[model samples]
Target: MERRTKQREVIWRTIQQAGRPLGPQEVLKLAQQRLPNLGIATVYRTLKAFLEDRRIVVVEVPGHTPKYELADLKHHHHFVCRKCDRTFDVNDCPRGIKNMAPPGFVVEEHYVALKGICPDCRNHGAGD
Candidate 1:
């Protein structure tokens, strides 16, 4: 287990309070609000240790950098706002998605990513 530090605690809390996955830069920016002198290198290093400890999981969206979220969240998927390029957690999963696979094919696992303008972007008239 990695020793707990203030920096690591801030980083973890940043992600936890976000209620959604956050990229390294996002984590650094949010965490810096509380720990003004926090450095990007420390954010990256802490994120690495969190991953090694299985305290977090990576959320990968096509053509975008990976983001991190807590590992203990219940099964879920993601949604990307095309206008703002922000990602949000989609807690509900469609039933029988595996049935979409061709006959005789095994569907061991899957990831669903819905893309559209989020409410904030849509309200701001950023995307149609």
Candidate 2:
């Protein structure tokens, strides 16, 4: 059995606790708190390995770098905060988008997003 390194353990545990998809920078920050010597490249590679093994899946954010989340996450889409630039999940698909696609295009995976002000942003009056 391969021995788990401190870096890998920190990276994995940090993201696991987040309970939400996070980008590399975010992962790096979290992991660094536990293992200050952890390098950015190391975190990137660890996430890449997890993705290859299907342990974690990528969170697709339009016009942004991809994020990572545990693969076992429930079927849900993300709600990105336009103001604070955070992301949250939505249990059900957004309203009014049916299973319609281009005539020749095959729909393999669908990602529905509701782009608007989140409660946090609304309370802070930062969403405009």
Candidate 3:
């Protein structure tokens, strides 16, 4: 039991440190640095538990497999730099939480994502 608990902690800390969202395979690489023998199943289960407890949330990438990130931190959306593939915090105005949900569904929060070339990329492109 203690072994499993330690593995879960490592996984959680890995996700927390990732800052941006990460998929299971990515989490496995980080957690393995601490617990090399950690099973992939354990990481998956731990993330699922965290999601169920609202300790983390899902970040869908359209056609890509969804990624997971730590919840309970400051709420902000992600902007993906198309040119550099960097993720940034938009920190846009907060609103439309309740208004975006469907009937009988309550939205306590939301994360808006914008994908485009960031300022750095744009500047680099100008040089090119």
Candidate 4:
């Protein structure tokens, strides 16, 4: 079993409290508020260890740096706001995605990142 440290606990808690996925820099910035000495190296190392131990999962959206979230979260897709560059979880997926693959291809897993203006940005006219 991995021995937990204060830094690891703080890092994990930051991700949990974020409510959505976050990239390494974002994680490091928030974690440092709790443990001021937190370093990028430690953040990366801890994230790597968490992934190896299956404690957390990676969120990948094309053209963006990968984010991380708790492994226990239910399966879901993601949506990216093109205007403000924020990403949000998308709970439901289109039903026929698997069938879109070519014949004879067994689709075991899939990831989708929808891009559009988020409500906040739209209301604020962020990109206008």
Which candidate has the top score in lDDT?
1
TM-scores of the candidates in the order shown: 0.88, 0.76, 0.67, 0.80
Across 1-128, the per-residue lDDT of candidate 4 in tens digits comes to 24348888899899999988888998998988988888999999999999999989998777767889889998898888777566789899889999999999999998788988889988998447
Best by TM-score: 1
Better candidate number, 1 or 4, judged by lDDT: 1
The residue-by-residue lDDT of candidate 1 on 13-119, one tens digit each, is 99999988998999999999988988888999999999999999999888776899999999999998777677999989999999999999999898999988799
Q: What is the lDDT of residue 81 in candidate 1?
A: 79
Q: How many backbone clashes does candidate 2 have?
A: 0
Model 2 residue runs over 4 Å out of place are: 1-4, 95-109, 118-128
Clashing pairs in 3: none
Query: Each candidate: how many clashes?
Result: 0, 0, 0, 0
Shift in Å, residue 1, candidate 2: 13
Query: What's the C-alpha lDDT at position 82 in model 3?
Result: 60
Model 3 lDDT, full chain set: 0.79
RMSD score of candidate 4 (Å): 3.1
As a whole number from 0 to 100, the lDDT of residue 26 in candidate 2 is 90
> Taking the tens digit of each residue's C-alpha lDDT, what string does model 2 give over 71-126?
99877988787676666777886554444865777766677766777788789874
